[model samples]
Target: MSWMTLSLTLIFVFIPLLLSKTLNLGLERDTIVAALRSTVQLIAVGFVLKFVFDSEHAVFIMLMVLLMIVAAVQNARHKGKAIKGITWKLFVTFVVIEVLTQTVLLGLHIVPATAQYIISLSGMVIGNSMVLAILFINRFTAEVETHRDESELILSLGGTPKQSINRQLMKSIQASMIPTIESQKTIGLVQLPGMMSGQIIAGADPVQAVQFQLLVVFLLLSTAAMTSVLLGFLSYRSLFTERMQLMKIDVE
Candidate 1:
């Protein structure tokens, strides 16, 4: 079996036993089965990506990239079911990060004006962007939901929606970007990041690979931070109205 398959199987078999024996925690057999299903899905994606990269066909690459974006948005939106305006939040998050990451890559000449370059860069940034979007969406939505009465009070006292939820907005935005910022701060200190270490081990010059990894981190930092803040603002829009009334975005 391929390494990926072998690893997937090992994880499928090992995780539950480890959880039960080491922590006495239970994800249930159903959870373990679901995790294995995800592994199978990823394995399928690996095959599709190989075809996309090798084909160098614009249509194929675009389709693959679009599929990836759909998957990402679905994942991010799923976590924010309480945030009534999930679709809008997802659009803002995806669009902002896509534009920012694309601009950075093209402007910096990190990759050529080709499908391969665009797809690869977007995939990397999108992965980080999804996490950022989910983090901001969940927290911002929950905070607004919890403090909704306070927001109404503030509105009655002459505060705009923007002004009313400013505290929670800032909090969620900050919380979303904390992981990205901390990863940036701690790389090479607390951990040898995957890309850099992998490049070095693959016989590339250590210094050169480190430089490439730095550039990746720089792009991810901007992509993740921008996505979090933009998504948070978009989510805020559905929570309040022009008349400063709380808009009930019923996820159901």
Candidate 2:
């Protein structure tokens, strides 16, 4: 795409800005910042990825993946700050998701060991994991806060921390995963996913594009489940005191 084509895309950004201003949503500045940030970040990443794709060094690929995970963890941690030590919890969950997904992809020979394939697929896994982590954290925190009395009652009745929060745990995990599950139900019929659309626009076979998009969809399903369950288990304990009493964090 040329500069002219890129300029045309700004109309989409302008629509958001116009709506924010007319509605008095006070989001015009944020909308502008997000558009500018996305442009700069994508362009910078394009250059960096071009170099890494050319290098094809295993070390560089590993480093890039690590950086992506760190960034993802940091972003997810924002929603989890009420839980102590949330960063490490998110980090571990993301790493596990990343490794497990990539292992299956590579082991099954579904994708080759190339920089482009690895980086693009890793981004998908990391991105999904990060969002799931944020969802889980936000929902979990809200559930605990809303049910603090019930939790404390359970504790007073001699229940363990896990037992006290078991319902909230399950509910939060289910809530966090709903978006992924629902989206997959209508994926091909309702939407052409990014990978598939890009491939088709680049003149690839529609059949081939569908196959790859299916791979990504399946990977996302796995990611959604793994991230929610793992992070839910790992972070829930931090919500309780050493005496198994409910520890409340101030809700925003």
- The numbered model that scores best in TM-score is 2
| CA deviation > 4 Å runs, candidate 2 | 17-28
Name the TM-score of candidate 1: 0.82
lDDT of 1 at 144: 75
Worst 10 residues of 2 by lDDT: 243-252
In terms of TM-score, how similar is model 2 to the real structure? 0.94
- What are the runs in model 1 whose C-alpha is more than 4 Å off? 1-35, 114-116, 247-252
Question: Highest lDDT, which number?
Answer: 2
Residue pairs with backbone atoms closer than 3 Å in model 2 (clashes): none
